[model samples]
Target: MTSAPQLLTDPFLQLPTATSVQVVWFTEFAGVNHIVTYGENLKQTARASTTKLSRTREDQQSRVASQNQDGQVYQKPVQRDIWRHEAEVTGLTPGVRVNYRVTSVQEDGKSVDSDVFSLAATPKSDTPLKILLTSDHQLKPMTAANLQKVVETVGRVDGVWFAGDLVNVSDRASEWFDDNGGGALFPGLQGRAKHEMTHNGVKTIYTGGQIIQHAPMFTCIGNHEVMGRFARTGSLNDEFDDTIPRVVAQRIYPDKSLIDNSFNTNTYEEIFSLPKSKEGEKRYYAVSFGDTRLVVLYATNMWRTPKLDGKFKGRYREAEKDLNNPENWGYGQVIYEPIAKGSKQYNWLESELNSPEFQQAKYKVVMFHHPPHTLGDNIVPAYTEPVQIIERDSDNIKAVRYEYPKDADYIIRDVVPILEAANVQLVFYGHSHLWNRFVSPSGMHFLETSNVGNTYGAAWGDRKREVPIGYQEDYVKLGDPNGLEPIVPTIAPLLGEDGKPMPYIASNDITVFSIFDTGTGTVSSYRFDTRKPDSEVLKFDEFKLKLSSLPLPPGNKFPG
Candidate 1:
C-alpha cells in the first residue's frame, strides 16, 4: 500500500532576519506544502499556507512524457515532482522573535506539517550582511555534507549567493535527490512521488523551493539558464521556459494556470523586485540598502546587442569587418547578431550607471551569470584584463575549444567601466562552475562562485594564474568528422517554448545574491548551497569594497 504524502524534515533551512525573512521546509512523501505560523515567540503567531498564495510566472507543462529507449527509464513515474517550497513573509518588522513551520501537501488535499523552528531578528539598524558560496559541485549535487554546511551557515548570515551550474542534467531520482532543480524544469514534477517510497528506501531530494524562498534571493542568469551553447546553433533546439526548473517543477505542483507567468524578465522582476525601479523602467534597476547599491544585468538576454556605438562600437566594428573575411569569418558569428553596446540595452545601461543617483551610492554591488576567469583554459578574452570592470557573459563557449566555457566579457564592454567610475564596491557572478576570486590591480574584488549544485567537470583550485591558450571555434558542418566539437541535447523542456526541443542548451543552474544591510555601510558576501543534508559551503570571503571616485578608466575601460 502507498503511504500518503508527508513532511520529511526538521529545522530544514531556516535563517535569522533584520527585516523581512523567507522561510523554507522540505518533504519526501511527494509534494511540499508550507503553512508558517509566526508572532511573539512561543505565543500568538499568524498562520499562512503555500496553497493559498499564488505566483505571477505561469509555468508550462508537457502534455505527455518523453519516450526513452535507454535503460535509464524508471519502472514508475519520473517526470513531475516538487518536494520543497519557500515563502517570503513580507512587511516583517525588524528584530523580533518569530516561530514558523513548513507542511507537506498532497493532491487530494492531504497534508503533513513540519516541526517548529524559530529565529531572533537582527535589529534593523544593524543588518547582518552574510554570504554563503560554493563552486563546481556537479557529480555530487546536494551531497549530505554540503547540505549540512548550508544549514549551519544560514542561521548566521543575513543573505545568500549562488555561483552557477548547480547540478547535472539528470532526471533520475538520484540526481533530483541531489540538486534542487537542474535548470529549467517542466510540469508533472510534483505528481511523481509517493509517501510510501521512503519506507522502501527511496532517496528523494526534499530541497528546491524551500532553499530559495527562505531568503531574499538574487538570481544571476547563467549559461545553464539559457540552456546550453548548442542552442546558439539553430541546428539543435531544446528550450526550457519552465523557470521553476526541472528538479523543482516536478515537486512544487501549484495550479496549472500559473505556468509561464511573468517567467522571462517579467517574472524575474516580480520575485526579485527590489524596493524600487529604475525611475520608470521594469525590473532592471538599481537598489540602495543603507550604503549599498546593486546593479543587475541580464547578459544573455539584453545589453549584448552588436550595434555600433559607445562601448559596443568596437565589438560591432570588429564583427562587421570580420564578417567578410573568409579565414577570419570562421571565428565570427553574424547570425546570433553581435549585441553591441550602442544597441538598446547598452544605452539603457549607460543611463542607469551615469545617472547622478547611481554615482552617489556608497557601496555599489554588481551581479550577473558567467565567470570572468577560469582555470588553465586559454581563450582570446582570457589574458590581459582589468579588474575595474564588472562585465559578465558566456566566454570559452561550449563545443568550441573542448567547450565554450562562458567567461566574463559582455559586462566588460559596458558595465565594468560604469561600475569602476561609480566606485562600485565589488562584483559577484557564477558561470565557470568554479569558485575563484581575483583582486584587480585596481583594488576591486571579483568573485566567481556557482558550485552550489553541479559544476559538470569545471573546477579550478590553485591554478589561479591560468588562461585559455587557443581560440574557440563554432558551427563547422554536418557529418564533418572534423566538426570541431560535439553538441549536448537539452535535457529539460521549457514551459513557454513548445518546439522539437529546448532552444537553449547546456544543463546548469543560475546564481543568486542576497544584499544585506550591515550597519556602518560595510557589505560582505555569503553563498548558499541548497542540496540535502545541508552542511556544505564554499569559502565565504569578507571585504569592504573601497569605491574609488576615480574618473572612468581611459577609453571606456570602466564606464560608470
Candidate 2:
C-alpha cells in the first residue's frame, strides 16, 4: 500500500495555455519541495520544479461551523498559516492525453505522492470547443450538485469560466478550504468534499464531483470576493465586517480614494495566476481558445449595495457623522471604480476588443461579474446612478442619505457603446441569480445563467419587489419595476414539446448551467431542481450561433 502526500488540498488545474498548464496544491509546512511529473502516461514523464513561492495569511482567518456536544452549531475560527505550491508544466503536445501527479518532500526527506490525474491541453483553433459557463457558487446547499452535473451532462469540457462570487467571503480561509457547513468551496471543486445539509430537520449528505481536476478553471471578481479590514484581527474574519464595505458604500463615499483604500480583493488575487494586462493584477483579461475569443471583465464593486445589512443590529454602524476616516465611519458608502474614458481597465479592454486575435476570431464573447442588463432585483442598484446627497441611519431605520453621482455608471454609459461597436456577439454575466437572456437593438446577445446556486428570486413579473422610495418613477422610465427590458421574444418562456414552460425552471431553487459547443455552433441551457435530489438534468433552452450571420468587422477571416 502507498501513502498519499500530506496535502491540504488536492492538485487543481489553473491557467492552461497553449503549451503549459499551472498545477497548484497546498501543504501544512513551508520550505517543502514539490515536483510535478507529466507525460502521455503515468509510466513515462518529465519533471518540473522550476518555481516555488511561500504565502502566509497572518491577518486573515478561515471560519467554519461545527456542532457542539449538545448539537448546537457555532462558528470555529482557524487562523493557521497556509503554504501553497504552484508548478507550471510546459512543452506539452496540444489536444493529446497527458498524465501528471504532484510529489512533496517533507522535512525528514520522506516523499509523498498524490493520486495520478489526467487531462489534455485546450483544443486547437480549428477544433471544436466545449465550455461550461456558470457563477455565484458561494457554498449554497446545491453547489456541489451543480459542478457534478456539469460533467454528467457534458462529458468533457475544454474549460470552465466562473463569472464571480466564487466564495461567500474572499478572505475567509475556511470558506475556501474547509467550512464544516455546506459551503466548503475547495471540496466542491475537486470532488473531495460533501455537504451535510439540514432542511426542515432532514439531514442529507451531498457528494461533490470532480470538475477542475481534469480541466482548467477560470473566474472573475464579484462583490463577495472583496473584503474590508479594520478594528481587531480575528473578530473581522467572516462576511460580517465584509458586507459592511458593500452595504455601507451604497450610501456614502466621502472621497474617491477612500473606496480603494478601505476594500481589497487581494485574497482572490493571491490564489490563482490569472492572465493580466500591462497594469499588474488587473482582474480582467482576454484569451483565445479554439476558434472563439473570450474577454473577461472584472467590473464589480464589492462595496456597492442598494441597502443596508438588516441581519445584525450592530452590522450597520453610523458611528461617524463627518465620514472622514473609514475606521470612524461605520458603513454606508458604495465602493466602485470609474470605467469610463482614461481608466486603466477601460484602456486594456479597448485594446483587447480591437486586437487582431479578438476581431479575427469566429466568435467574440465578454464575461463580467455585473449584468449590464438584468431581470432581477440586483439590476436596480447595478443600473442606478447616484442622484442626490443626504444622510440617514446606518441600519435603514431612518429616512436615508442621498448623494447624486456626477456621471452615469461606466457600463451603461460607456461600455455598451464600445461592445456594440465591436460587434461582440455575446455578453455573458451573472450577478442576479436567474436564467434569462436579452438582445440589444443591434442584435448583441446578453445572457445571465448564474442560477448555479440558490437564487435571490427573480426580478420579473410578479416576483419583482417594490422600488425603493423615490425611485419608482426612475425604474418605470428605465423599463419596468425590475428594470428588465424586452427579452428575446423567442425564448421568453422557453417551452418543451408539451408547449408549457419547463417544469422547475423558475428563478429560485432551480440550479442552472450552460454549455457552449463551438463545434456545433450551439449553446444549451440545462437546469435541475435543487429541492429534488432525483431531479434530472433537463435541457430547457438552447440557441445556435452562426458566425456568418452575426455582424463582424469587414476585414476578418470567416472560418467555415
Candidate 3:
C-alpha cells in the first residue's frame, strides 16, 4: 500500500520576538489542516493554525519545446505541489522556554503528532544572547557534521544568522525537500537524516543534532537564490544555468508582466517569512533583539563573469546584442541592482542605520552576501562602465587581477563610509567559502567564516611570498603593482608544534562555523578536521570587540 501524504518535517522556528515567534514546517499532503499548540510547559495550551500557501506554475506554452523521434514537438508542465505551513504564535513571555506540539491531518484523514519541541522567545535587553553565525551550507557532505558541532559546542543558541546561499539552487524542490540520496535538508537539520562523506580516503556518516527545533534561523539571499532562465524548462531542470531560453529571463519566471527582470528571488521570498521595514520583507529588513540591532541587506548582483563566453557564461539579451540593438546594447554586462547613491535599498539602509534604535543599541552588525574586501575570486566587479575602471587579465593562468579605482563602486564608495560613521561594530559576510579576517585602518572588523559546507579555495599569497603552490594560479591581490602590498591577513596553512607546515586542506573541503557571545563580548571560531579519526572540534581563533558607548551621531537620531 502507498503511504498517504503526511507531515514530513518537524516544526522549526523563525522570526523570534520578545512576545511572539513563528513556527514553520513542510508536509507531503496538500491543503491538509495543521495546528501548533504552544505554552509554558511541555503539555502545551495556546494554539494557532497554519496558513497554507500552495504552489502555482506558469501557463502551458511556457515550457520548453522538444522534438521526439517522429519529428513532432511536445512540452510537459513539470509542476508538483509541496505544502508549506506556518503558524505565528503570539503573546508569549520573552526569554522563557515555551513547549510546543505540531499536529497535522493527512490527506487520508489520518492525524499525526510531532515530537514535543520547545523554544524560548527572543531575549529582551540585559538578557544574555548567544548567536551562531554561519552561511553557504548548500547541502554538502560535511553540512550535517558542521551543524552537529554547533550544538555540541554552543549547546543552545538564541538564534542563527545565515548570511545567504542556503541552497545551491533555490527553485529545486529536492534540494530543499528530500534528495533521494538521503540528504533531505529539513530532516538533516531536525537530526533525522545523515549523509556519508569521504575525505582523504576515510569515510564517515555525518549527522546534525536537531538544532532548528529550538533556535530560530534568519537568512540573507545570495546569488544562488536568484535564478536566470528563459523558458519554463529552466525552472524545471536544476542544471540549466544560462540566462532564460529566450531574450528576457529575469522577470519571466511566473510571467513577463513585471519590470524588475534581471533576476528574481521568488523561491527565497516564499520559503521564509522574515521581519520587514516599510520596504517589504523579501530584500532588506531589520530586527532588534537583546542589546544588538541587525541590519540585513540584499546587496549581491547576478552571477555573471567578466568575460561572457556563449557556452558557459551569461550573454546580453537578443535585443540588446551588439549588432541588432545598439540603442540597448552593452558587452560584458554585470547585472545587479544599484544600492549606492539614490537607490531604494540605499535609502532604506541609510534611514535604518541612522534610526535611534540602531544608534542606541549596544551592538550594530550589518550582514550581506558579498564581501567588500574579500580575497576570493568572486570579489571582482564585472562592469566599471560609468566609472571607467575595469579588470584586466593577469600573467597568472586562470587568474584576473585589478587595481582599486580612484572612485570605487557604490558598496565601498558609499556603504562603508556610512557604516563607519554610524560606528557599526562588525560586518559579517560570506561568498568566499573560507574563514578570513581583515581590519581596515579605521578599526572596522570584517569576518568571513563561510567554511561551513566547503570552501571555494582561499585568496592566499602575495608578491613577496610565493603564492601557495595550490592557490598560485587563482590568488588575487590588491594595491599598486609596483608598491608595498596592503597589510592584509595571508591565507597560510596551520602549523604543528614541530615547527613545520601542516598538510594542505583544499578550500572546498574545509568545515567551520563561528559564534558570538554578547555577555562575554567575544567571537569564537571552531573547526572540525576530518583528517583526524577521533578529532575533536578545536577552537582556532578568538577575538573581542569593544562595545560602543558614544552617543548617536549628530543627524542619525530617529524620532520617538
Candidate 4:
C-alpha cells in the first residue's frame, strides 16, 4: 500500500518586499489545493501556485525510503517527483510579525498542515537586523550542531545570506528535504532535523535552528548548485561532473540549448524565488533589505578533482582514456558564467554598484560562491577560465592539459577593483570550508565564514595546496593568492599547535558561524565545539564595518 501524501518541507519565507513575502513549500504529490493562512485568527488566506520540479532525482547513494537499506535500491539515477507550492502573502504591515501556516489537500481528500510559524514583511531602514552569514552546508557533519547553536546563542535571525553550496548534488531530492540521516537542507534550517553527532563517545541528537521559516533567505549559485550535462543511464554524480564549457558544448551540439548540453541551474532556480537582475535574472541579482543593498554574483566555476595521475579527469589534465575524445574532457575547471570586464554580469554589477540605491544604503555588501581571498586549498589555481594546452605526438594526441593565468583571475582582477572603487563595505563568499577574513588596501572587508561543518585543512606555514608544481602559471602554494593578509579574530582566536593565535578556523570538531548586524555596523563570528554538546557558543571575532573611504594598509590589525 502507498503511504499518505505529505508535505516535504515546512513553509519557508522568501523574497520579502515592503508589504508582502513569498511563502514556499514542497510536497511529494501534486495537491489540489495549497494555501497559506495568516493573520491574527488565521482568517486571511492566499492561494498557492504549484509546479512540478524538473530535475530532482535519487541515485543509489541516496538516503531515502528503501534506498537507505544495506543494499542499493536504485541501481541507477531515477527521477523523484516533487511539487512546489508558493503563495505571496500580501498586504502585510512592514516589520509586524504575524503567525502563519500552510495546508495542502491531496486528490484523495487527505490534507497536511504545517506547524504555525511567524513571519513579516521587510523591515524599515532604521530597524535592527541580525542576518545569518553562512554557506557550504552541503549536508556536512556539523551543520546540524552549528545551526542548533545559532538559535541557542542569538535566537532567530532577521535574514539569511547563504553564499552557496546548499547541497552536494543539485538535483538530489533527498538532500533538500529528508536525507533520512536528518541532515537535509530544509530539515536543518527549519528545525526538523534529527541529525546525530557523537564526540568523546557521547551521542546527541540535534535539531537545527528554526531560521528560514521566519526570515527570508537569499542565495547565490555555488559550483555544487550547477549540475552538468544530463545522463539518463549513468550515475547522477557522473552527470554532475560532466560539465563542459559553453563554447565547447555549442561546438559539439550545435542545436541543443546551452543549459541542456553544457550545464544548468534549473533545480536551484526552481527552489528559491530571489530578486532578479535585468541581465542575469535570479542567477545574479541585487536586492535591498532595509539598510543594506546586497549584490549577489554568479562567480563560481566547475570544481574538478585535483588528481593528476591521468587515471581521472582533474583540474590540470584530462584522463588518459578520454584524451582522444574532445567531448569527454573536463576542461580544467572552466567557469560557468563570465563576469570579466565588459561581460553582461560585469556590466550589470558596475551599474548596480554606482546606482543610487546602493550608494544610499547604510551598508553595501557583495556575495558570491568562490573565495576571492582565503587560507583554504580551494582558492588556488586562480578563478579564471582554464587555458587548454594540447600535447600531440605528430598527428596523434598524447595528453590534454590546462593552465590558469593569474592576471586573468576574474574575481581578483576584475570584480574586486569595481567593488573597491564603489566603496563596498563587505564581500562575503565561500567554497573553501573555513573561517577566514581579509581587509583590502581600500578598507573593504572579505569574509568567508563557512566553517559550518567539515574543513579541508588550511594552507599556511607548512600546510600547502596540491597545485601543479611545474605549470606555466605560478600558483602560490601558501597565503592568499590575491595578495591580501587574513585578519586574526579580534577575540579568542583558535590556537594552533604552537600555542599562538591562528587567523583561520579550519576544524572538523569546532564549527563556526557569523552574524552581520546592520544596527551595530558590525559582523560578529561565533564558534561552537560540537565535541562538547553542552558547551557555550563562543564569539570569536567581531569587526566594525568601515564607513569611510580612507585606505587601510594591507594586513592592518583590526581594533577590538
For each candidate, the alpha-carbon lDDT, in order, equals 0.37, 0.65, 0.63, 0.90
The C-alpha RMSD of each candidate to the native structure, in angstroms, is 14.7, 5.7, 7.4, 4.0
lDDT (tens digit, per residue) of candidate 4 on 1-560: 96776789999999998899999999989979999999989999999999999999998778987678533788788899999999999999887999999999999988989999999999989899999999999999999988998998999999999999999999989999999888899999999999998877899999998999999999999999999998723877788888998889899999978788899999999999999998999999999998899999999988887778999999999999998888888899979899999999998988787677777777889999999999988887889888889999999999899898899899888988878877889999999999999998878999999899789989987998888767899988888988889898999999888999999999999999999999999999999988888889999999999874443344332221
Q: Give lDDT tens digits, candidate 2, residues 318-395.
A: 333334344434334343444666777788777777678888778888898887876655655433334333354664
Clashing pairs in 4: none
Q: What is the lDDT of candidate 4?
A: 0.90
Question: What are the per-model numbers of colliding residue pairs?
Answer: 104, 21, 4, 0
In candidate 2, clashing pairs total: 21
lDDT per residue for candidate 1 within 1-560, as digits (tens), equals 76766553332223333455555444443443345655654343333333211111111221122432322333332333434455655445665546666555676678776555554433342344544443334333332333333444445444444333332332222332322233222101112222110213434443222333233334444433332111122111122211222222223335432333212232223223333344424323454443455665554321122233322212112233433232221221111112235655556666666655456655567765544433212112321121221122454211211122224245554556555665666776655443334555566666654434344333222223222223242311111111112111222222223344321111223222222344544333334434222334433334455645743433333442
Lowest summed-lDDT stretch of 10 residues in model 3?
463-472
TM-score, model 2 to reference: 0.81
Worst 10 residues of 1 by lDDT: 53-62
Every model's TM-score: 0.52, 0.81, 0.80, 0.97
Query: How well does candidate 3 match the true structure in TM-score terms?
Result: 0.80
TM-score preference between candidates 2 and 3, better one: 2
lDDT ranking, best first: 4, 2, 3, 1
**RMSD of candidate 4 to true structure, Å:** 4.0
